[model samples]
Target chain A: MSTEISIQRSVKPLGKDELAALVARDIAPGSFVNLGIGQPTLVSNYLTEEQNITLHTENGMLGMGPEAVGEQIDGDLINAGKIPVTELPGASYFHHADSFAIMRGGHLDICVLGAFQVSATGDLANWHTGAPDAIPAVGGAMDLATGAKDVFVMMTLLTRDGTSKLVEACTYPLTGVGCVTRVYTDKAVFLIGPDGVTVRETFGITLEELQQLVPVPLKATSAVGV
Target chain B: MLQFIDTVGEAVAGIRDGSTVMIGGFGNAGQPFELIDALLDSGATDLTVVNNNAGQGDQGLALLIKEGRVRKMICSFPRQSDSWHFDEKYRAGKIELELVPQGNLAERIRAAGAGIGGFFTPTGYGTMLAEGKETRFLDGKWQVFETPIHADVALIKALTADRKGNLVYRKTARNFGPIMAAAAKHTIVQVSEIVPTGALDPENIVTPGIYVNSIVRVAGTPAERAA
Candidate 1:
């Protein structure tokens, strides 16, 4: 298949923090959320101080907080990405199996994950690329993908080469089928549904302009403002 | 009835060729590096090793695999950027791999310890990973049956242990250690020190003494590393 065609316009990509903030605004208070490693990890940094979201790290933490700030850094306390973090009050630790049980038992209300490509029908291809040198590292993504109540993908709208990551079908090895519920990107936000991808909101572009950046069909529903 | 071995070599003496071993660690955090070093000298072959992250960056399981001792790896994530040995062996068909979803792998080990035959999970449901597995709709979602994973031996690293073999693991370093101790036929633990039986508070113990078969005091634990 031919690669995604990009018609560059005057849109300046949103900074990393903006993309994270956009995702943070949607996580309902008191939601049990698991943020995938990498870009998605930044979402925790943007949540409002009043929100009572319970962050989870599949490695073993249930109520993880932001990166610790102090000379007393306990490197042992880390998120699933193995980055040092501080635990919130009421945080509990358990066996690795129990941690996985929380993930695979459909207990997580939401999971924000980084992705290489996401299909219009909400297929996720984040785990393996099958690159000759790429290591096959399939972690808890599969469990979180299927187990979470709603899966949100936090990623850049386009790859470094200006190719749309929103595709008709994923080329990489899939993590889960029909798992993505929404996507928050540097350019725009999309809701993946049976009717295909719809523009829930855009950063600084019009509906017509946002349509030009994506390879998949963009549906503008009446619920865009909400 | 307490079993405490003095040397890493003696702790791993029971492990044989072609044995399935579950190793505890997420990356190098809780890795029994000293025991792994001792195994390099044993020269065993055709072993099936399991863990979360594939070892990388100059030590532990990565180095052991380079010595041509492991035949297969059954793990959740089997690749790190520096895991060149596994990449080369996997691409060349020299090594085999069984990539289980992380949660599934964790639960399978737990199943073995819990005396459960098998259970259904929705993790791998419509993906390529779920191919040919026995799947049925459970409460409106497709679930696949996963069997328990029992290993011949388990090599685990812990922060501290009592004379009774009660283990206490530190923070994220406690990743797979507890479950692995219960899932293996023989569980060998390497800890910073071995305290007296009553020295450790029962509330602080993560893995009970019942699951541990042997304990070895490893060098360079947190106390040593901090010093």
Candidate 2:
């Protein structure tokens, strides 16, 4: 709850591309991954060709290529975001049912999503803010949260008001119950599981500083590094 | 037998008010805009429409909602930056909404087409959406029961079709088209080109003629097609 707590040491939080590249490096090669529409989409830009990662868009395609430009912009060819996109070589298209089946059936290995809040026990709340006036539009957030083998979240550690998004329990309406496996944030990367929140790596803050920022109890992994 | 209709008006003719219609598309891709416009012209009202989003801008489904033709919208993501039509109608209590999860929506439609009664899935379990649904612990996870979504008519766009009504879609525009064609009682399609029967390769055919009711050839709309 304290916004004024500052570490004596200088620490700059990871840049947007830096955070995205960090996530890209962690994905296993040849894995099937679905990146949620917003911030998670940045991870795709950091992916290396050798990773051989196949992108899955909930709308209905596998082997999705990058955003389509100029002559390549086909209305029919698009990502889940509905922005025009291209198809990679060896790409295959299916109907909506089969596309979701790829996720719900556990064929997808990893999915990265942006979150409004993530509970210590891995509960995810990203779809709706539970506001009365806001129109509720939950696309594939629930499906991806509960369906993927591992649900990785990409979000800022704190809101602009300096409140921690990683909470003991989600204040927003949950997208999935205890479904998150890892969270990649601007401040630190956390691995959530039965034991508790583990600080895998920190960007600009120390484990001790992050512990003070987040409400949940945090433990550092033996592998923690800058 | 599939009939090649000459006009969008004739293609969408005979749709009664209060009918459940499935309009295939993910956003604007694969949406049968001409057919939707024709349906609008037919003066059908109080219809329950199903699609991914409620509507994007003041066109296609958006225009229909703007005209107050749709009574209810069954979709996953109805809120977008450009979804002002649905947002206004929803806020003003002029429209009804059934916000199903994307996966469940797709599966429910598929179940209807496949003639399945109902099935259980973990997509919405333990969430607000699963509140009243039956739940069972299956395959090491809690799953919620969901039923099929059948429709009186379906409007879909595709790239190419043969005289037999075999379909081949262009890229991601294929979303919801195949399942919707099967889930509806009558499936009306608009294609860029329609070839003679047996012109389509059987193996490459996405939706077979059996599921399709009628077809219309729409010369590529200048704005919609790739430049």
Candidate 3:
């Protein structure tokens, strides 16, 4: 039998700046987006205002703008995390029931979420780690993950200890199963396909170099660099 | 008429122990203190309280925790306080604690009010949250089905109410009061002021009188009263 050749054996690494720029480039204009807490929240500030993207918050606010500046902060207009925020010109307020209706009813076009781990099959685990020291809390990340039309993950490729976050399976509690369509990381952009992790681009590193970064086995198909 | 009561004690006369109560608030913003006081005076025990957060210290729900009346608490979190009796009891396995995600807790209450049996959401999958939960595949993704939550007694706060029980809330204090009003079997509201039936504008009434079973007019500083 002929030996199978692995294409991902040679891939490159990407820097953080390149990852953020790639994320910004991919966000289409006029999309309804929900940014998760922490780093995902930063995506709102970087979004180009000319794109006409509307932000929906689960905490009963819609048409959200970037975090407020000195005079624009409204105590009443806040995000799901209870952080003070600014309202867009056409912002509207309603009972939170309607806000969740929009979420569960599949009205959101895109949802970017921060994750603790992403499995090879695109399963997401971001809430609790089940560690004794971990806080027992799972926020709206669950609803946003399952409800949004497209779920995109934003996280570092590896842990502080150099453990690869993109793994064969998640060890932490999962937020959604097979919900992740794309992943944006400090390393490189990857699309989770049925075949395996497909590299869209490696910021500065080569395909072979990037393959070395992940401890898990990766199948590099012809789709690499696409 | 059974409408007006001077003290919270008079309003909570028939309430007994082992009651499942829904306490309104998002954090400590809109808790119902008058009813809590009345429950304290009634010496009710074995309470199952559903609220956004446990009161800070001896302030809101903390009072009940201090009194040793709560047998179980279903809330999002307990903030601003340390050494709470309920926390101690929870740690010692003396009480039951069901912690829910803040937004999910809110949706469960709202769903009960809307008369829906259950709704499917993809919030908690492949985690401990998925354990004992039914999941379905929607749009090529997994979603967990969460059931609605209801309560026997709902305690709420209102900025102003008419004699007929039309209610209005001031600001963020409006958090879960309106929804709890519909989800509870018996809803009792503590109002700062009570006016004539027609005094409140139709547009200003946040909660119509139909869902309200009783009204207690509290006389004190806004901070002295809960909610």
Question: Using lDDT as the measure, which candidate wins?
Answer: 2
lDDT of each: 0.83, 0.90, 0.73
Worst 10 residues of 3 chain A by lDDT: A1-10
Docking verdict class for candidate 2: medium
The most accurate candidate by TM-score is 2
For residues A111-219, could you state the per-residue lDDT of candidate 3 as single tens digits? 8888989888888888777786443556566777777888889888889998889888888877777878888886667888777778775545656877888755565
Which segments of model 3 are wrong by more than 4 Å? Answer: A1-25, A65-77, A133-135, A215-226, B1-14, B32-43, B55-58, B76-87, B101-104, B114-125, B134-145, B158-160, B168-173, B190-206, B216-227
- lDDT (tens digit, per residue) of candidate 1 on B125-157: 877788889999888877899999999999998
Candidate 3 vs. truth: CA RMSD? 7.0
Estimate, for each residue in A12-124, the C-alpha lDDT of model 1 and write its tens digit: 55677767776787789889899999899878877865678899898887888778777546656777876678877889877688888887778899999989999999999
Overall local distance difference test of candidate 3 = 0.73
Give per-model TM-scores: 0.90, 0.96, 0.80
Model 3 lDDT tens row, B1-227:
22667777877776778998898865444667768878887888898998866655566677887777888878765432353666666666676777765556778888898899998766666657668989898776677788898998898887788988888874445667888888888888888899988999998788889878889888763434432
Decoy 3 TM-score against native: 0.80
- TM-score, predicted candidate 1 vs. hidden true structure: 0.90
Residue-by-residue lDDT tens digits, candidate 2, B134-183: 99999998899999999999999988889888899877788899999999
Candidate ranking under DockQ, highest first, comes to 2, 1, 3
Considering DockQ, which of the candidate structures 1 and 2 is the better prediction for this target? 2
